[model samples]
Target: MKPHVVAAASLLLIALAATTAGAVTFNATDAASGTAGGQRFDQAVGLAYASQVLSNASTFIWSAFNQTSPADRKPVDAVTLVVADVGGAPAFASGDVITLSAPYVGNYSGDVKTEVTGVLYHEMAHVWQWDGQGQANGGLIEGIADFVRLKAGYAPGHWVKPGQGDRWDQGYDVTAWFLDYCDLLRPGFVAQLNAKMKDGYSDDFFAQILGKSVQQLWQDYKAKYE
Candidate 1:
């Protein structure tokens, strides 16, 4: 296994212990009820985020979206589709809970045990990550969160390899792999960068971390993989 994968696996073992113990509490009634996948998230993420019961599916969507939206994430029934459609690519729709589709969650033909666990960790990172007040590039925002998931030991089986992609900021595993390289080059690079984004993303944040411009960093990152 790659070093990042090994590290992430170790981290997941530790986090899973804590996650299972109800360290993060959320309202249960707020989430989708009677849905198998929804229930899985309720036990895995919702219970971990807050100890409260999710009243129902609509409530769950509202609570997650409202937490992140500059405007209140009004309660809506429309989010049921979101919960059902978050496939291999997980994203926050309308700035609310990180939604993921099933394909992204697991091997289509295999048992979903590992896939769900890994995706949950990744999606949960999005829920908590700071996005530089929309000033940060969306790709970078996603990269950072995936980096956390990479660190947390929940990266998927397919993420075991890195490659040459369109750009370092192509997002998802592509950017995530670049961030892993940065972590190796500069320990705590991802953590420190995340702190910077919390204050509203700025290109200068790159200079602070690596003493290089963002463009320069992207170039270097791309070269490493290419």
Candidate 2:
């Protein structure tokens, strides 16, 4: 081959590599920089640390979902985190953006950085995980996010123990524990469930994956601990 042609091919390869590596970009902003909570965030969880967590959480979520290739994952080009004086929940995810409550950060009495990291992980899971195209159970969606947080080893001390929830889809920690039980029954069950949820959700998904209804599985899980 000609030298110029070889050089052009090399440049093309480099460009492709850069594109692949830059598929997902993370950004963080201290929107509530003037607030006490915002100051706490700056001291304990700066924009750089938050951005890093976003990247790390994305990588972890991909692996947890068994999405080995770009084709298998959601096409999210960017994820942005904003620390602001928000009310209600400590943090929430909307589309690809995550907003952390400044008040929550300021008032938290424990390791704020670690707590924020866990929150980011849960929110990042929402950014990546499919929601049965908006047809899945709300509790299951939240549970899956918490499940990802649980698998990442950041589950908080206050979270409920396995088999303690009133139902399988009670949401948050309760649902997360149940999902963990389901995953144990069939290794990679969570990943499989997430993949199936890409298009839609059905109660029968539990039966299809584990040959048992979700209710029955919940009963069995409770029995083990009871």
> Which lDDT values do the candidates have, in the order given?
0.52, 0.89
Writing each residue's lDDT as its tens digit, candidate 2 over 1-226 gives: 8999999876553222111123788878787878999999888888778888898898899999999898998888988888888888999999988999999999999999999999999999999999998999889999999999999999999899887979889999999999998998898999999999999999899999999998999899999889
Model 2's alpha-carbon lDDT is 0.89
What is the per-residue lDDT of model 1 for residues 1-226, given as tens digits with 9 covering 90 to 100? 9999999876554232111111232221222323555555444444334222112222332232233342332222221113343444543433334444533322244435445445544555555556777788888877765665666565777663675566767787778887787667778677677666766877787678888776787778777656
Candidate 2 clash pair list:
none
Residue 85 CA error for candidate 2 (Å)? 0.9
Off by over 4 Å in 1: 1-24, 27-107
Query: What TM-score number comes out for model 2?
Result: 0.90
> Model 1 clash tally?
33
The local lDDT score (0 to 100) that residue 118 gets in candidate 2 is 97
- Worst lDDT run of 10 residues, candidate 1, spans 17-26
